[model samples]
Target: MRDIKIIWDFRGPAALKTAEHHAIHLKEYAANCAIEYTTIDIQTFNEFYTIAFIVVKEKDMLSVRDALKPHRAEVYIKKRRD
Candidate 1:
């Protein structure tokens, strides 16, 4: 029952803002489509690169991936608060 991270990458000066906005749409899509997700977030690498990602259970990956057509994906590892 592992989780999967689906990621969409953005580049250029507007990358950060674009990634953030994409995360918003990811949330809306999950809500409207009744898609289960652990979280949706944007990661800033720098002014030139950013990514929007949605984490969902492995079982839900295919459906979400097909619908979203993200740039890439990987196994999701939850970070400990500590």
Candidate 2:
């Protein structure tokens, strides 16, 4: 299975905690799922921002997205109006 990454970015005073909380939600969502996903956080630019991500099989991308949606962290491909 090909590995794919999905991330949720958090910013502000409680960014780190928020990212961790978000990771927990993702883990819970993946429980009993067919995909193998790992949750991790990256501290970007000091400690004011943290990004939590899941590394999962490419085929499980949709499932991952579902878990990420509640955080409004799902990445969307926007079509240009031009």
Candidate 3:
């Protein structure tokens, strides 16, 4: 299955919380729309930034994108077919 990973990077004060909050939105959207996805929040210490990840199938990309349109940044997509 081909999947796309949507990423949002947040920095500045309370970066971690901001990223987590964004993840919450993604999770809620998926739940409401009955979509399956994997989300992760990571804190980077080098310069202090948080990363939010949303992994969903290629077919579900648009729905996820629209749902996360408010705060969009650093979108990295991954795909694999085997």
Task: Rank candidates by lDDT, best first.
Answer: 1, 3, 2
Question: Which parts of model 1 are misplaced by more than 4 Å?
Answer: none
Residue 6 of model 2, lDDT score? 75
Best by lDDT: 1
TM-score winner between candidates 1 and 3? 1
Instruction: Please estimate how well model 1 matches the true structure, expressed as its whole-model Cα lDDT.
Output: 0.94
Local distance difference test, candidate 3 = 0.69
User: What would the per-residue lDDT of candidate 1 be over residues 1-82, giving only the tens digit for each residue?
Assistant: 9999999999999999999899999999999999899999999888899999999999999999899899999999988998
Query: What ranking emerges by TM-score with the best candidate at the front?
Result: 1, 3, 2
Report the C-alpha lDDT of model 3 over 5-79, residue by residue, as the tens digit: 777778887787877788887777778889887554454554568777777777777877786763453444544
TM-score of each: 0.95, 0.67, 0.70
Identify the superior model by lDDT, candidate 1 or candidate 3: 1
What digit string (tens of lDDT, one per residue) describes model 2 on residues 1-82?
A: 5566677778888988887887777677677565575444444655787877776666778776775563334432334998
Q: Model 1: clashing residue pairs? A: none
lDDT of each structure? 0.94, 0.65, 0.69
Per-candidate clashes, comma-separated: 0, 0, 0
